[model samples]
Target chain A: MTRTVPTSPPMRRSTVADQIRELILSRGLRPGDALPTESVLCETLGVSRSSVREAVRTLATLDIVEVRHGHGTFVGQMSLDPMVQALVFRGVLSPGDNLRALREVVEVRMALDLAVAEKVVAAAAGETHPELRALVDEMLTHADHGETFLDADRHFHTMLLESIDNQLAGQLVGAFWDIHTAVLPRLGLALPEDLRQTSKAHGDMLAAAEGGDVAAYREAVIKHYEPLQRALDHAN
Target chain B: MTRTVPTSPPMRRSTVADQIRELILSRGLRPGDALPTESVLCETLGVSRSSVREAVRTLATLDIVEVRHGHGTFVGQMSLDPMVQALVFRGVLSPGDNLRALREVVEVRMALDLAVAEKVVAAAAGETHPELRALVDEMLTHADHGETFLDADRHFHTMLLESIDNQLAGQLVGAFWDIHTAVLPRLGLALPEDLRQTSKAHGDMLAAAEGGDVAAYREAVIKHYEPLQRALDHAN
Candidate 1:
């Protein structure tokens, strides 16, 4: 009898993995949902155990699946911290384009800043955190000293996130500033006027936040980023 | 004699490394430009070699500093792919409210989809590639076939990217999709109209591209994701 033949698929491991992922997506597998055992996957996918394991490993890296010490692999949900770090790591690899790159970073920053301010107002209805208030005062006090102004300014913007109490967001935004400040001089792009203009945005944000005027708060935040955008555009 | 014990100045490795990075960003240090070496950094920063090396390593991980095995570390250019992957990873990560996370990801997708459409039209404006046309037809035929559709669908969406002929953009977008399709379910969302709406977006995108209307192409792409935003809202 002629031996039976099968597809002899290439990249069997990847195929098995995609199949598994598809199942998870469609079936709404929870984090702990037990996948069919390794042996079962091998038999079903017509692949070896090693191939199945490799697929599982890749998913694990993405944190979409987890392999426990004693238990079998299950769906995973990792918060985005590790993933975010990975992105900045890769961002730095690009060739000399700090000027443009910084500008791009600022683009997202402006949008995020506006969103942050709006959320704070919505959540708090114009109440200000004392710390945020103090930081605002500090911004005004040090306004004439550019370096001092910038430091206090960085803290104040960060405080807005702190006021909202979204730790994940605070960290993400903070990370961006950490990077921006770190790369600023290398890009050799700065506009004192931009910083001065930014102070007004802060003032506007604070006023709107205090008044609990959601519309004004949103508009203020968006306007705040205008100078940053202009500065970035000039850098570009 | 009890020497006056002095508080050690905070390790300035990060500061030094940052300065070097600034140089890279500012265009003072072009990609592939050799760094002054451990000895040089030490002299410039008034720090120890170990500190310098640490800073270099930090930069290396940032992908800002590339250490050639023998030649030494040099200033590096930036690549958008790595940077974008980093952002998407971070964005998904440390995600706050489930709704916001989903909304943010979908919003980003909308932006990128516009970019992809524009690129596709720009690249494929004058003529069509038979391969691309075939892929679209295959996708149209396989629509609603689930597994089959998904496979062809990947190709079809990917074709828009290929139309741009920009490998880095394709890679970055591909990475986002990797994250997208992975958590497709836990995301507790899909287009309100589901695949039908997704298909409509694809069809409209292709139509705009084929007709060579850049603005219309972008508009169609932007509207295509409306279902995605609705899905997120509905889930919330």
Candidate 2:
């Protein structure tokens, strides 16, 4: 099949950044892979050293590249920090009575939990996550003491996320979790009188994991977040 | 109920950044809200001016604040540029034969698309999006001419996302889409032989939207992505 080729445009000063990004990607550079020195980049791209430095700095600010002191520039680790911060900022800035934003957050979290649950169950091969079981136990113990088990509750979900063994999944889940925690205070959410129900929901999930039932696990995960969903509905 | 409050520790330099963040949140600062001058912040927090500047600079780097050349610093708009860049970088850097990471990306995209479809269908109230109809028409026309309709394909999904009207949702879908596109070339994905199938799937989605049948809409979406999923499976 013949396709038309578009005419090429002249490279302007601003094209330097695009060129550099293409260079890095085309070279298949990974995190910690060093880029050519500024002088070399300048000579190769036929751009000034200052322009190359500026472009590199801009990339660094976006977490695309890292400049180590006393060392050369290298590809940077993928980070969810900025995304997490953006979510928190947007959540807080959402207009009054705009519960849709909150709902979207909850919806995304539930989806992620559902996906991660299936992964955790699959990874277990009909076994259960021992760390998740321990966390659930800690949650029950704290609830029995009439104390909030937020930390243990967080750990339970985090443990399941870890079993997925995907950095992207972990980062996205963690970022959304931060948004949920940040908004919880403003929602004035109180612990349900029957914290035991919360425990029971988690127990169901653990059982489903043990049975390798993905559908049941998803249902249990949804049940676990029902209280928060209810609170959000009431707020709306 | 009695709870013990921990005593405050002596002021640490590193705490200055946290204190500034707290100040911003406590004040309910929004994007474009100007922050206090460096001198004022230093005095209010009982920290040195340099420390105040350093904190502000760090925030600026994270795109949390914008320092105008002439005017003082202000809160920055919520941005997903960094997150998009991070996703693209991570997708490229993923180790060889890492089908799990690709699966996670596909899972998240499917979940998001499902949620957005429900929202779009509900919002339509039995009416279909005319813009989507136009895009689909363009897609079929292009497909008939032996051209790839990737742009129209993207617009159709993006239009659905816009109808949801949640910035967080749009940002995430765009980020995950970036990862999907970045990995597509590596997968050596080719167009499916049955262009008519692709056109029919979209037509079904449009029909579901008109009928306000969310389940049907979601099914159509899954059908739309089937080609890519098959390609990934083959690669694995």
Candidate 3:
């Protein structure tokens, strides 16, 4: 007796780009894994070379597929770069009422940070984040010199979520931070007077986490955003 | 006396796409605003038509620009569509260990919902959400019949964020929900048996919000996700 195997139809029957994505998924390809050649993909998917190339380019924009100049196509890093770009564009487009967009970004960031406060504090129990402390100290040093501590500030926020297992949340935090930095200058707003106070909030957050005080960590998170909130209000 | 005005250099001077984005920003274009013709854009940016087309395609992929078949290109909606595509692709790519991705998605959703618990409750204080109540009733009706209530579920969550003045948060919530639904079937896991209980949690959440009880609302949110968490644990 002969046996028959059943095959399901394509999950999403839309675009050539989606078909390419389906090919990637069906092949169980991981990031950095090499894909078939362009011509091979064309033959496999029954499409023209230009169609395949267009699909590839679109996928590359989404960071779903990586194209190397000398090498060949491969699975992409699958980063949140697209989200960051879209957000930055949205923030940029709303030049007149950009404060609304900026406030939304800050509010979402604050929500995410606050939601993870207890988990972050729990993860910090019996563990000392020397890197976090060092970042805070670096921030304070920059504050004392009255210079912006952008690198340290970015790293400090990134490090805060290092203990959490959720990569999406961390990437989101970083993406919002990127949007804030990218759009802030376009508003032509003045900096808050107390850079030291904002810098010290980072230290307070670290201390609260190290001490396993969720309430304090939550308070520090709010305090960290207070300066920016005030600055936004001042701009209004 | 003659005076010279200083011009700042381009912020991101890498790609033609970046140049096009800068052009859009410099012109203060809004969504649905028409862009220059292809040849005009090429001349303005001092690039070839092919280069301009490529940049436009890239921007279109990011939803920064929109292109019509016969009509000219305009600014896109700048939605979280790119993020949704990236997330859905990411979730689909990791088929073998998809539980991890699903867990992250759920965690982030829970975090956002919890983070907005108080605000959502406050927003619903004086407002009667007949739509929300109807959705809960629809969910319960579907559960009674052993059917899935996907549309009502999605609408309910989307409506929960409607009162909040954060478009990004709402879009993110919708994006994550889309990912969850898109990737869940691929896991080949059985649906949990407590459909009515899960459906009832929606009602619980609505009641808590209507009662202006933040703590109860928070509890309802946790209860809402408990079934999925248990199912995941069982799968593990």
Candidate 4:
């Protein structure tokens, strides 16, 4: 059975998708809102079920709606991964060249990084997750490896994000990593002094994590990002 | 060929995708770096070609890898639109009121919006694009219908992005619109008063477009968003 098929003409699926998305977005439709059943949709939109189905499928990919087996379709609250993936991909096309845009990106990254750090501290205070400690070991292993260390470094941050347990925030931050890579090499190797400071600061961050000191944890993260930004500026 | 695949060990596609992505990200492989052919990748990772293809496809979607029609895949440069889409989708999935996250989203939106406006000032200077003017007309249609002017509002900004001819930036900004729908009712009525103010501001923006006065254009956009932000706060 179809839901409210939009009364639009050919290419009805796109039209239906657009209208339904428009309503859900404008009216703030939530889960369980009965989308016009197939018949109602057909009557309303004056379209075929196939068109409705296609529209519904597109929405499904966006996680805008869920099609149940036998039961009626429901609204979907999907993960941000797909959308995040698209943004990062597009950002890749431009390569972040505008000095103003780059600066803005960095500034925003700082806020997100700080927020993640704050969360990490809160999580640490509540419990000692061995997984977090294990990252330190991995970091050490990467420190020994020449080229492979970057992955280790990324892993440390990715792990830190996981500890925060905000997947949406994590995904947003992940996009930064991609853009960062596009421009990072121009920034040059971390100054030994900067790396030293980073390591020491990381130690402090670990402590904050252990102690569950939200403020300190957040500060530590900001501290880490600051040098990276400086290094990036130097490269650019 | 799959590089990160572990055939005998049954390595997961995600594992391979992650490793390859990191490699590209770390500048181990630069943009235009010819990614290893599939067979080589399979041999290196001891995995099947199918696994390699899957991994590459994921990276392609992320814009981390691009496969030519006949040529092999190469590392993708930064792309913003897809990443933003993915991020926004993830944000929608996150639990909580999302009001705070919306603030961050708005922050990014403001940056992108202003950037596009600024770019339009550059690109549309003395250039004639009836389409943008047409968007203004479309806004009127929406206003006449007593329908929400959000789509037209979005189209206007999108027109600006397109004016600057930045597809990725446009996509990032579009994703923001999609996510911001959650806060719409609280955002503002887009009532006659708001629409008039918006339409007037848009007219001024067109003047800025003709004059290439970026600062003036940005100010005009600020005028539009400020009330919307306040409405959001009031609604929440």
Candidate 5:
């Protein structure tokens, strides 16, 4: 006899999870603070040990809690891992067709990059971000090296995002960047042929950042994406 | 003897899952397309039945695959459910005191809303979206109704997002909106006290959309957010 398990939902509703989450919030537990023990949670919530355990497991998966061996569970640092995973699956599971979905990711990235550029420029106020400058310098060095220079590129953007001091925006942008880098390779996509142009675009952005010019930053951002736009246009 | 069963992740890594995802992509399986039988997947992937089942469970949890009760598994529609869940948890589990996290959510929403408004104005080109018009009208009717007019507000924003024909951006905006709505109640935050001002903001946005004026739309978007900004400012 084949006993079948029911199809699970895309997102299952979890009463136990909600209760535990509430407990964390209500008690003001910090990221590293230990949650109540299983027995205590079970008794307090009037649920089974298995249910309590299940709830923590779910929270852990969502990056909301960390379960340590013997030490007990603690609240986890917030992360974009879950969002990144969702985007990866989105790209992977997309039916073979036009690169519309991947292109959408690019479009969102462009919007975010433009926003970050403006914020960075306004905040810098004619001052230089040494870190950003260093990254751009490294990018120039690696421009014609036939390598992706992905690390410097990523750090430059990440630094820009961090400078804004907005964690949520950073996570959203990081998730999309992760998706773009991950999906592009799978689709047999490569960087633009003219690497020097790419490095020059970064330089322009750096200059705009130092000059506190939002308009120049915006133009530089558009220039930076030109190669990507060209690549996407060709893919289409 | 305390033998510990490692807490299972909300999403566990599964090589079989990757293989199965690749299989779906390689086979050009669209959403709702059924997959091979359990026996076939096991045979083809050269994995144990348990591994295949576990992988499928992981995929289902990720919303990458849908499992039917007895009809076998199928590709699942791409969703922002996971991202929304992550954002919700981020809000819920935040250490109290600073609304920085919540404020960040608002800022991201503002950026996306601006983008959405621009796109809607460009696309409509002097034509009004009736659904949006109706929502604004409803807001006006409820201006003094002492209700929050939250539903109409959400619909107006959601409708604007959908009109852009970008599912990814819409899903993203929708996710942040979900996070904001879910978090605000928990924080005991309320709408601005002046209902008329709120209604007027929406009216201004509608007028801009109808008139195909991007600058006016942008101004209206900023004005519409003033209440929320004031609320956040008061909280801070």
Candidate 6:
């Protein structure tokens, strides 16, 4: 004997997801808080078990909801992981000779970093950032070995944004950085040949920040990304 | 008689999603390119049919894949819709006395706008944006009636970003604006009472752009967001 199942349309799944989101909000559920079980949600939403399961699966991708096997569902951390994934996929999907997606990511990253230069300088006023200095030193060491310091470079940018006191900005910096790093390799694009120039740019940024020269810091930020921009242009 | 079904673990679902993404990348599928059918995907990935369905649902949420009813799944538009949804949900989940999520959105928007201000001014040099002026006029007309011009305000910012020639920045401006507009009403936050002041800030922005004065334009952008900032602070 064969059993037949009803197919839930995509629109219905989306509506069910929205309803679950509304349920979470109405109940004032925080991240990590347990949500109603699958059967419970099915009954509450007046939808099929398959619909609830599909909706939960969808929300989980956005980090809006978390599902733990055997344990049940809960609120999610709501991180920007989904954005990074989508961005990286976009970069990967761009046809050869069409690096617009990656270029757009770089432009936004530069814009945000340049825009926050003054704020970062102000936040670092009369304060020493040993952590940032350490990252720069690590980059320089890697440069001396004629190798790229991807980890140090990522950490340096993340640490720089920390001074701005904007969590969203910090997360964006991280997200864009992840996209750039993930996409560049897949495109067969090499890092700038002049690792020293890149390393020195980080040093210049630190010096300008410590000296509280916003103009110099902004210039350094531009100088830092210039090499990567050239590589992208060359690829295009 | 009762039928038994096996439950797929969350990790398995995630792995299947990754494999599907890999398949798309390997096949060089562009947005709207249809994927193999569910049975084909299950056979190819060697995963259970239910696992493939759940994985597709997850990928659909991130917009990495699109599933059309009665049609095959295809590569998605890969737009920033998922980001906007995640951000709006974040803002909505913030309880009273905590407007941090919304404030962070505003700060990022302001930073991005300010960062691109000089570019916008340069791009507008020797050129007039009739569309932008029309938006400002629409905003002013709304102000005269003691009402808010949300659509005009949104379009104005969007048109301003277009001058910078950065697609990602434009999308982000739109995304954050959506979040702000969607979240503020839910929080029971009211727009600033001085509609005239808010409307005039747009005028100043336009005037500054037309004159190619970056400083003035930056100031106008800051002024435009100040009232909203004040509202958020008051809410906090």
Best by TM-score: 3
Per-residue lDDT of candidate 6, residues A95-205 (tens digit): 463788888899999888887788888887677888888888888999999998887888788777777867788888877888888888878888887788889999899
* Residue lDDT tens for model 3, B90-125: 876675674888789889999998888877898887
Q: Write the per-residue lDDT of candidate 6 for residues B1-236, one digit (tens) a residue.
A: 12111111113247889899889989988999999999999999999998898788778888888889898899998777777777778887885538888888889999888877878888886678788888889889999999988878877877787777677888888778877787888788898777888899999998998899999999999999988988887876
Candidate 4 lDDT over residue span A70-184, tens digit each = 7877777554444444433333333445443444455556556664665667766756656656656655554444323345455556666776555556655654554454334
TM-scores of the candidates are 0.53, 0.77, 0.91, 0.47, 0.88, 0.88
Worst 10 residues of 1 chain B by lDDT: B1-10
Instruction: Give a tens-digit lDDT track for model 4, residues B1-236.
Output: 11221111122235777556655545556567888888988887777887787677656654567788589989875354333433343344332464555566666676666656656687889776677677777666765665556656666776677655445556566667655654332333232345556665766777787787888888887776775667556545
Q: Compose the digit string of candidate 1's lDDT tens values, residues B66-109.
A: 78878988875433322333333333332345655445455445
The digit string of per-residue lDDT tens for model 2 on B50-117 reads 77876665556556677886899898776665566556556655636456666668778876777677
Q: Which residue pairs come into collision in candidate 6?
A: none
Superposed Cα deviation of residue A193, candidate 3 (Å) = 3.2
Each candidate: how many clashes? 16, 0, 0, 55, 0, 0
Local error of candidate 6 at A67, Å? 2.9
Q: Name the lDDT value of residue B53 in candidate 2.
A: 75
CA displacement after TM-score superposition, residue A112 of candidate 3 (Å): 0.7
lDDT tens digits by residue: candidate 5, B1-236: 11221111123455788788879888888889999999999999999998888677656655678888878999887577656666676775562648777888888888987867777787767675777777888888898787677677777777777778677888888777777777776677665766777778988987888889999988988988888888878775
Name the runs in model 5 displaced over 4 angstroms: A1-11, A37-50, A67-72, B1-12, B37-54, B67-72
Give residue B206's error in model 5 in angstroms.
2.5
In model 2 chain B, where is the ten-residue run with the lowest total lDDT? B1-10
* Native contacts kept, each candidate: 0.01, 0.31, 0.52, 0.13, 0.30, 0.50
